[model samples]
Target: MKSKIFCDNTAALMAAVREGAEGATIEIAAGVFELEATLELKARMTLKGAGIGKTILTHVAGWKPSTKSLPDPEMRLDGLDTDAYLIRLKRDTAGITISDMTLLGPQLHGAIFAWFPTSLHLHHLRIKETLWSGLRTFGMQKAKIHDCEFVDAGGRWDSGQPGVKGGITGGGIFAIWMSDCEIYDNRFVRTRTGPAQEFYGIKVRQGTRCRVHHNTIETNFSMEFPFENDEDNEIDHNVCHGTISIPKYAGGVVPKSGRTFHIHHNWMKDSYALEFVRNGVEIDHNLFDFDVKQDHGNLISAFGNVAAKGPASFHNNLVSNPGRGVIWINEVFNNLEIRNNHIVTRTTTTPRTEGLFGFNPGSDFTSIAIKDNLVECQGLARPLLRAPESYAAIVENNKLTNVSDAKKLTNAKANRPVGLENPLAFRCGAHEEFTVSGWKVRPTKK
Candidate 1:
């Protein structure tokens, strides 16, 4: 059941897809195909184009998306408007590949919407300027979306719209209930401003065993996996100008393989690098480089009555010019270990005398360990620990410069993280001509 069609116009393209058998390959020619309605993707088919920017697909002139809010059976949400998408996968579609075209949008929802697709592959496509999101999915498995560009891809999160935090907010790639997916080597950028200016780069809910790496995202919230039982997720080797947010106890019960999430080896330039607490997570071998002039936010912060189930650890990180100090836990947390890091702080407008680490007095200090750290503060003296005096017993073998009578001070060398080089340095975006490594601190591999 294999067939091939070469089409240039909308009618030919639509007829080719509708009539073509399974395992068909439709190669769209170099022209602008104005879509009259949603293009349904068939199973085991390939939608090919001449090239990006050479072949374009967009909505018809004066066409508008339906304002109806329809229920999505895949996500179990009554918020999505299916009439807003240009291309959609057929129910229970599998082994579909869409590549080498521009899905231009300022459309209502997004460019491509799918549900319950298996082994879907998307590459070398530019999804730009969508009102909701560039790509939206539900229950996608073993999908690979790489080398794509999402430029100004999402906005429009008004109240009661069913998004992040009940606000209809979307992102460049918003997928709910995804598993075994790999999203890498993509660039998510916001170039222009309008009502479509607020969203995340990659937003996932209940994602399991997903690997997100080698991306250069410039959105305000680069990556978010929040408020779900997301497990066995790996985030590493990327360049993020915004926050890598995984808060609200997103890590569920640790699997027998150990650790719900493994986050490491990423270059972070934002002051608010990471968000709240979780259990059975290991964060190591990362660079948290924040400029002194940026807004004040902690590198790691948690607040409110967070019933944290612990055994989370952060070690071997290099932090520079922390705006409001590191690791501020406002509530009682247990089984957190912070060790073998180097932090350097300079004189800033904010309080310079605050402790580098602060925890609630009611926390189980016996389970917490802050050891083998090297802190160097220029000009003023800063306290090592700001909690109760009992915390002093846990703060052992730290080298705090210019702090008088530091308890258990040691002359041993700090265990700095090796191979802290930026992986995406000197690499530009795949489609666009944007330089990724324009930061002040660019580390090359030695």
Candidate 2:
């Protein structure tokens, strides 16, 4: 293995890059640099900062955004294009590990990203003031983001265009967009937008087989963190916190499975809106805490729905002092299984801890089973009624405890009757089974 190569400026770095072969480890010393265009790395390169603590790269204040500047909708650029960066790659830059640097994205233009790239590894870095996304990955595989921090991103939140999408500019509205990639061990705070608007911390879309673990995704003003429309992804051991700010919308985790999404062993706390639509949801060994009751419009909740149906499998989870229950399948669906969960709801949250009154499954769901769980009904229980679509909901052999209010139990509001007369004691403080940030995002070896 070779020792190292040093570069003073981006031009020198590009010169070394052009002269080097595959698998080059370029050690960049701590310095300020300029970037006018996208640096394409065709080979596997490890661009290491002298030290993550000492290395620094700053860019020009970039393009300012608005309809006036970008007359063309085809413009990829978004806000003040502080897109000039320390280093960014385009085209087949695989096996690349970028470590230890404070790379700045500050421009008076649109999105700081003048170029879009695919397949890269970013480790131990800090990015501030990205006009669009902090990191833009088109469609990459086997890439990882580790030990990074994004502070006060998604700059300059105006009333975006009428149909302007999320994670567009300045505000880090969009960070890390890709497929089959892993985003773990990162921090996003004060990554905000305008008054009633917070932006998305991490967005997963058009991606598969991706895992998001051990990240503190919080403190934005416009939208939800981990905004997921992506399919067949695993979101485990993540802390989803803070006031989810969207103007006319509510934010929540939707099980996009059919398209395929599996949610297991994750903590959902201080959340605004979470929904499930058109998917098979496997919710197991997770904790749901809906602490702040600031009213996300309709009702402050851990889980709420617009189109709620689950080919939904919910088991082995715990909900304590939240604003709602675990299952709120408001629409119709097949195979709704509820098992082995500790559900606790205050009287101020909903009517009962477990019931079929508010959100029910579709009539076509014939397989609805509730077994081996401790359920507390502060107000009413057994308001479950079956839909006319054709279904069955059976409750058997479980501990239904602390349900003393007799006026809350009525007959069949939405599903079949299985009201338990003999119940057991319920516990409130049950967490999950696995450790946090279980996957490694950065590999030390080349």
Candidate 3:
């Protein structure tokens, strides 16, 4: 049934909800409510902000709780208490829908970090202008964010000191911090922090499969972030603006343990900010923008992002005015197939050693293949810009405009990287294994 709770008191509204029955609607009146802490969500309840734009839940920014000091790959930013995630729903809080409310995350870790399962829907809402991140998710499945706006404030990660880890991690409006999310038809705009912390429209960690489609990711000075350890993800049909990174962030689309990626129909803009990456991805129908030089993060210097991590494949993509025709592996990867791709190089003519960075792995990229791909460069360019010193694989049959741009890179004084040992292809908990008939990543230990 329908219910209206008018009054600017959030505590009173929460008390009302605690006193009310399950599946009741809590229609907050149009006004501003100052929240001191997180307003935890109830089971099966719908929190509809009064008329979308009229009601605002302004939070008083405060100190964040620390999660980890070392910044491991798998830890969720929950403990950080960085920013106040406006609302959170956890454990068996099924069938919840939040609509038309502008949820603002204070300058903490993230605006929203949820661990809810069993069908959650976020519709027609706008989450923007936060500090750490706009929206983040973990261990949530069947969740949907649509007709929403994740406008970036451009909070870049803490990088570029004598000892910084390459920009900062948070900021940006919508970061699906963990895994198993679906965001579609959303509008990401403004993106204030050009090439700072935000770096992505939506990103995921490991052990999740997300479908990001029909959305607009526009950035003025941010890099589309890294999707590390995530698997079975699909990014498609999104109209992107400004400058965005290619492939699926950092981890590529091949989940931490699975094998496959579906990335297509994405239009990207190019930036010359310079960054580093070590991802091995296969993209299709994606449009990459052009820049004076494409090495934004200095992956060449760090030598972590240039490893060859493919024997995989992605085909039929469009590259318009892209910097380089083909950038070979800089890291170590095994098995790859790169074909049927079109490339138009050189939008900017500030000529240097630019146009597609080729392989430069220090060691351990085994079994790879490349064939039937179109390659074009504006000036005298070489296909093999840089080859690694010790790769277990080889490169061949790729089209090229110039051959001398071909080069190799290998430095003995780089950080020797590490990866998870014997990662899982899929995993499950007790209830999830019980619910879906006979799909098991592992049997119950108990």
Candidate 4:
């Protein structure tokens, strides 16, 4: 075997990358490399560092950025643009692997960014303190990002930057128009700087056939893939301190396989867990545990002007201390199956008087089923199903404790639930999720 090419300094590393052959392995030694401009990567290259935190890459002191504005691939944003990045790959580049490095920044832009990379692999990276996202890519295919630590990796758009209409821009990983990807074993965290209005763990727009599992996200809005025709996306085995949001009305229709997203087996520590009005989703076998004293909202809510297009199901889950209620819908919802879940509410300062499930007017009761759920309100006497007379027929086989008027739990005042009107504004910065009308915008280019 040939001897490995090692670069001990920034000059040697830049020279090796500029002169190295394709498919060459370049090892970076343990030191801080402050770059003046973005490090452009080539195809079929491997850039490995000594180890996490040992090989640090950052910007040079008082580095000035180039004013570049690229066109948005999704056509929703005004323009795709950025000022700085530690490393960047040209479009359509393939087989690029980067591992075991730290990208430190309180700088202008992201750590690693690209567009239309056919294949990209990243692992064991410590990315922190960037103004923009830790990683941002567009139209990537067959990518794998795992075992990365993102600490305060995004804060660029949370502040009021001029010309940015939407306040929520950056995140830990923001990939758009991606397919066939696996993002697992990652940890996203924010420091004690304060709460942020818009900073997500992972936001995948127009994602297909993606699996995001085995990750721990501590941000308020953990993961979001909203209304971009996302199909065959599986989100499971994760721990979220806040909400796991997949905005309602995904792609406006279900895929031919009859599902849009399958979410299961997550440990949710907050009461405001799910946000959905999407068609063809099944959530099961998870734990939604919340402390009653914490700032809380409904367990599941769908806020929109329209109903779902296809069927959905929620079953076999365990919920504790459901703060406001469970399965609250602001608009008409049909063909939803809720069964085999155990939900219990403890003693709280503000008791929930309504039942766990609430629907808006014009819901089809014949198609919705609520059965086999064991609901126990610790001391408060609440109804099992609190809705109009139409909801009286669908309640079946549920074991209730401390329930008032279990047989006829109908209420005329249950038509329009409060706080459900602004469904798009539930979380801190949810306006950005629906700002572009993403369901109607489909990119013709790959």
Candidate 5:
């Protein structure tokens, strides 16, 4: 197949592909091409642009259908009948690359909707302002999304309520049923923020051997892994400024049982950091930095099957300036190991309220271990670790300062310096060379 180049007409670009220009390099020159229909790729090819923000592709105006009879259908961003996606990679297509382009979906439903691709690579692309989602893929074997930016992706849905559970769905990148995929060195910024169904920076569900690392997700709401039985997934070295939740019912299914997930070496600051409501998860060597705000607070919150029989470990983490508490061990499951963590409270003279750790009601700590932790507070007067009488298992070597006596707690130590520095100074985002574990990271150019 011969390579073709299109400068202005997007219809000619699609026409070239339809006329058996498969397995070829289709270069789009530096200009704004308004798409009239969804560009479909059926064969293995490369869709390259001049550069990011240099070659622009956008939707045609009046693309959204109008319904005058259905009582203000203009306000409905969801369920709009549009057969338009900026790029559609059809099923069973292998070895496709879409790189170095700015896809602006103003009236389109989604930017890229790909399914069942054998191999897909999205590199150095800026996909923004998408109405539904930036990039959505399903049933892929090998996929690599690196050095890309997904900004302001999802749109708002009106469920009649204004501030409460507004029906907002879709955002950033959502990959499901993927195997051996690497989503790294990407930036998801300013995504839609509302209810849980509204927006997400990056969401991977029911994936196997997927590694999502070294990505910067700064948005109203961060990441989610909802469904269960996702085996051997690693989320590491990412910096998230918002909430990273594993909700109780993601995709309407309880992920009570699954393979273990290793979450480590990440920086979660500002909002609620890690909210895990499932088992088979390990969180370690992460920095949870929260500068006490009344609206947005809390560090680590875990609530799930209190009777599950597996062990989950939270170790070697640094928690600083906690607004609500350091850890909210809501419901006690079997065998939770909290060890080697350093918790330091902010210096405040406002009467020293709020417990360092809050144990919610109906929590049974029969087989939980809290050991070798260092807690330093400035004005907290409450008990450092607040829990029930049954929560008395292996609490030892915890050095405390400016906290009340460890009467109910056992094996306590004292007089330890709060020598932990700010962990946010370390860079957790993407780098030029991908030197992490799992997959070998490489840039697009080289």
Candidate 6:
């Protein structure tokens, strides 16, 4: 393996990159390297550093040079004309690996920007304090980003930058038009000290065959799938401490109609665990603990004309302490299934609110099934499922506890008092199961 060493100069580092072979590895020594301009990378090489905090790369102060001076410039750099990035991977570059480095961006842009790379890997990196996203990739294939930390990204509050007008920007990681990417075992935390914006921990648009799993995401908006037109993408086994949003039409871009999105085996501690606007989505085997005191604490909120596109299913989930309801169905649908789930709510001092499940008025349905579920609430004063008189649902084999109203329970196959002694226990993967009684549901079915 051919190698070159650079101490603290980015210009020399670029020169070394230009002289290195295709499979060479550039070892950056421990020091702070202030970049006067973006280091354009067009070769299939490895940029390795001593360690995360030991080797830091930062942008120059108030210096925004033209991309023409870079090694391989593209017209898309016009979007970043006024801003500067620490590293830019050319579209022609492939098999590039960046590991064990700290990247700080003060230009209100991204730390690393890549376009159409065939292969890329980023591991063991600490990317922080970016004005916009920490890592932005467009049209990349076969990418792996793991064991990295993205902190204090989307620094709009501190940078005084106006909110993004049209496109989705300012996040920990933003990938547009990507394919076959794996982002796992990473940490995304927004530590900005100010009002939050419509940013996300990770945002993917028009992506295909991506896997975002085992990530610990903590931000204002944890994840967003704005108009994903792809198929067979998986978002599983993630610990999200904020809302997972699928924002409505913003800036003339509506959620694209898609198929086969598997969202399962996740732990969410937010008001809205999964808020989606499109159809053809499956949400299962997740634990939602709504710790936020919001008026509309819903486990799943499906909006738009979802029934027109394709079938959607929500099953085998556990919801605990939902402030408002369990599922808020806004639009009419042809096929919708909510089965084999558990919802538990405790008595609250606030006035008893609406039912546990609310379906909007005038919403027509062709085929809807709600079965084999359990609702255990202590202090709710309304019916468990509220629907219009015209809307007829096939409800069966559900157990209710401490609910007085029987208007919606007329179709229940069986009603029995919830046993408090056995309680509920849940475990994901190979971990030990933890038990919680008196209102918490188990991860799996009884």
Best by TM-score: 1
Ranking by TM-score: 1, 4, 6, 5, 3, 2
The TM-score obtained by model 6 is 0.83
Off by over 4 Å in 4: 1-4, 64-78, 156-166, 195-198, 390-393, 409-446
User: Would you list the C-alpha lDDT of every candidate in the order shown?
Assistant: 0.76, 0.49, 0.51, 0.73, 0.67, 0.67
Tell me how far the alpha carbon of residue 333 in candidate 6 is from the true structure, in angstroms, after superposition. 3.0
Measured on C-alpha atoms, candidate 6 has an lDDT of 0.67
- Model 4 per-residue lDDT tens digits across residues 336-435: 8887777777766676566778886677787887776767788777766666654644666677777776657432232322211111111111111111
Pairs in steric clash, model 5: 168-198, 352-379
Q: What is the TM-score of each candidate against the true structure?
A: 0.88, 0.68, 0.69, 0.86, 0.82, 0.83
Q: State which candidate, 1 or 2, has the greater TM-score.
A: 1
What digit string (tens of lDDT, one per residue) describes model 3 on residues 270-345?
Answer: 5332222324444655544444555242211123453434435545554544443344344554455555565555
Question: Which ten-residue region of model 3 has the weakest summed lDDT?
Answer: 430-439
Best by lDDT: 1
* lDDT of each residue in 1-446, candidate 1, tens digit only: 58889998899999998888878999999989998888888999999998889899898866676434522332564666766888898877999999999998764568999889999999999998776778989899999999899988875533345443323567899999989999988998988754437778998887799998878898888888887877889987777888887775523566776777888767778888888776778887777788877738788877657567577888877778777778887766778888777777777676556777778777777788877776788776666666664353365666678653365333344454322222323432222233334233433433
Candidate 1 deviant stretches above 4 angstroms: 66-75, 157-166, 194-196, 249-251, 389-393, 403-446
Number of the candidate with higher lDDT, 1 or 2? 1
Candidate 1 to truth, TM: 0.88
Q: Give the backbone clash total of model 4.
A: 2
Each model's RMSD to truth, in Å? 4.3, 8.1, 12.2, 9.8, 6.2, 5.7
Candidate 4 accuracy as lDDT: 0.73
